[model samples]
Target: MKRVLALPYLLWMVVFVILPVFLMIYYSFNDMSGNLTLQNYAEFLSSNYIKMTLNSFWYAFLITVITLIVSYPLALVISRLKHKTFWLLIIIIPTWINILLKTYAFIGILGINGILNSVLEKFGLMKIQLLFSDFAFITVAVYIFIPFMVLPIFNSINGINKNLIWASYDLGASKWEALTKVIIPLSLEGVKSGIQITFIPALSLFMLSRLVAGNKVVTLGTAIEQQFLTNENWGMGSTVGVFLILFMVFVMLVTRTKKESI
Candidate 1:
């Protein structure tokens, strides 16, 4: 009876998930003439693609690190807050807005003569260019991903056994020592989950690179977009897509926690 009920979901996965992946893999190996070729994969191995891939990984790593740095303390504080749910909801509300809308909002705020620059001008400071730079790109990405990083860590921290912390204090551990040795160590699973959540999406953020960085930043996603949409090279695009999929799977594997057998 349970299997019967799950049949629709199984069918859905076959149609939507499994079929599309197979199609992408098939397209990745075929050239414009529909002839099977390794040319697309070869192009991906060239200097240009390799450099772009490295840049994408670097930016994603930066975004992940920044988000983690900012989020961990914030999550820790929120977990100790009187109204934990309210604060968590506040963090999550921004995610409810469309990502496109959020990105456009940043465009206005970061643009020349925009709110930030106008404030700087009022303070008799130079109107620095904020948009279309690496700083702007990373800042916006961090802002967007912070909530994702926080939620998991907050849950982990909140679920910690208070007795262990008390035991540490009784053993004469300082506050910093307790945090470093006890709390952070136990919450590593949540940190891993947050990294898996944050890093993968950051790697493939095409719209942010285009709209925010003004094409100055070309991520792996941007490369795929250009290949498929601008250059009309679907084969190469699919090849890049395949590589990205494999990389995401690798990240998931690396971050996944192994269960200990009793």
Candidate 2:
């Protein structure tokens, strides 16, 4: 009966998720002539693709680290706040706005004669170019991903046993020591989850790189987009897609917590 109730979901997964992956794998292994070949994979192993992959990883790592640094303190404060729900809602509300809208909003804010530059000019300072740079890309990415990083860490910190903290104090541990030893260790699962959430998507931020960085930044996702849309190289696009799927799986495995047996 339970399986019967899950049929719709199972069918949806088969049709949308499983079928698409299988099709991508099929396309990835076949050339334009539809002949099976390893040329797509070979091309991805070339210097250009390798460099792009490393660039993507580097950016993803930066985004994750920055997001973690900002989010951990914010999440810790929110967890201790009297109005936790309200603060969390504020954090999440931006996510409800369409991503395109958010990106465009940043474009306006980061553009020449935009709010930031206008403020700088008012302060008798030279206007710095913020748009189409690595700084703008990373800032926007961090802004977009902050809520995702915060939520899990907030949950983990909030769920912590207060007794343990008090016990640490009773044992003569300083505030910093208590936080470092007791709270941080327990909250690691949330940090791991946050990294998993932020890093993977950061690796494949195609539209953000295009719009925000103005093609100056070309991550793995941009490469995939180019292969499919601009170059019409579906075989290579599928190869990249296959690699991305593997990367996602690898991240999930690394972040997943193993259950201890009793």
Candidate 3:
């Protein structure tokens, strides 16, 4: 008992996690009328709530797909590099910058008469609408979250035993089949961890999407922000916050079950 190693983290988790959650639970049960009401949950499960849920899920899914498409091979290449320190710096340096700065940079580059449009106009193409649209939101969110996906996959690939690949080759397995069967399975945990990291953040993308896409793209994060900041609806805001937590929990449970079965 004296050597229990998780005690500090456990204490931190209880203080940080349990306390805030308890507060949210308390607030979620109350209504604007100051009476206990299930209306919050009821409203959350309504058609509009369902659409928000689907929209949030699909939006996150799209970001996840884009991140995977872009990051996997980059991670592979970086994982094999001799100058890993330099490349790792390249990967991690962006995270140190203010997220708002990165988000706003997109506005400067994509707004009307911005970089892309300027290049197009120089090439004799007509002006185009890039800002305040779905593309703006998706692009920024993906740019912001790409590192989250890459680092995890890179770390996972780094952990793979080199001898495993050699052994597969010795067994006459082709490169494609070896990668498909051997490398990918071992890295599923890291990929899953990465997806969880990226999914939660991507689903909750607000400032970037708001700044870049304007109001055209409304996400659960932006909705909660609106509820709290713009609408002054504390009860409803807490309800949405609670719903978001439960949604993450549901995803965790599903992923845990699937992983255990695998």
Candidate 4:
């Protein structure tokens, strides 16, 4: 009976997720120049591809680390609140806005002639270049993706049996020890899920980086988009897309293996 209602969701997922992914894989293996060729993969193996992939990973890693640093404390603060729904709404409200709109709003706040730089100049401090750099890219990425890190960790930590925490305190164990040994260990799934979310969206952070930070700092996403739009090199673009997909799968597999080992 439950399957009757679940069938639509299953069908929806099959149509949207499964089909598109299969099609993308098919597209990746296809090469133009009048026939399908292995040239796409070989071209992607060039130095530029290697460098772009590394750069993308480096930026994504920084964004993930920064998001973790910011979100964990916010999640903790949130956990103590009286109205869980209210606090959740407060955290999630901004996410409802358009991503492009949020990026532009950050630009208005951080750009050289924007509010922050203007305020700094008024105070007679150094007029630093705030926008169109790695810092800007990362800061925006962190702001955008922090919620991904938060929700999973929040759910993870929240699901922990409160009695255990109380029990540890009653047993004369310090709160720090209790959290480190008991809470965090049990919450590992949440942390790992948060990391997966962090890495995945951040891995595809082309639009925000290109929009908020200008076209200066490039990632594999930008490289792929360029191949599709600017260069109109669909074969090469699809090859880069293939590489990005493979990287995501590899990361997910590694994460799954690590979790299973534990």
* Alpha-carbon local distance difference test for all models: 0.95, 0.94, 0.82, 0.81
True-vs-predicted CA distance for residue 211, candidate 2, Å: 0.9
Off by over 4 Å in 3: 1-11, 257-262
Q: Which candidate, 3 or 4, would have the higher lDDT against the true structure?
A: 3
TM-score of 1: 0.97
How do the predictions measure up, each by TM-score? Answer: 0.97, 0.97, 0.91, 0.90
> What clash pairs does model 2 have?
none
lDDT of 2 by residue, 130-181 (tens): 9999999999999999999999999999999999999999999999999999
Q: In angstroms, how far off is 67's CA in candidate 4?
A: 0.2
Which consecutive 10 residues in model 3 have the weakest lDDT in total?
Answer: 253-262
Q: For candidate 4, what is the total of clashing residue pairs?
A: 0
lDDT of 4 at 145: 80
lDDT of 1 by residue, 1-262 (tens): 9999999999999999999999999999999878999999999999999999999999999999999999999999998899999999999999999999999999999999799999999999999999999999999999999999999999999999999999999999999999999999999989999999999999999999999999898999998888888988889999999999999999988888866212
Estimate, for each residue in 173-261, the C-alpha lDDT of model 3 and write its tens digit: 99898889888887777677778888877777878667887877677888788877997766777888888888788777655635477
Q: In model 3, what is the error at residue 200, expressed in angstroms? A: 1.1
Instruction: Please list all clashing residue pairs in model 3, or write none if there are none.
Output: none
Q: Which of the two, 1 or 4, has more lDDT?
A: 1
Q: Positional deviation of 192 in candidate 2, in angstroms?
A: 0.8
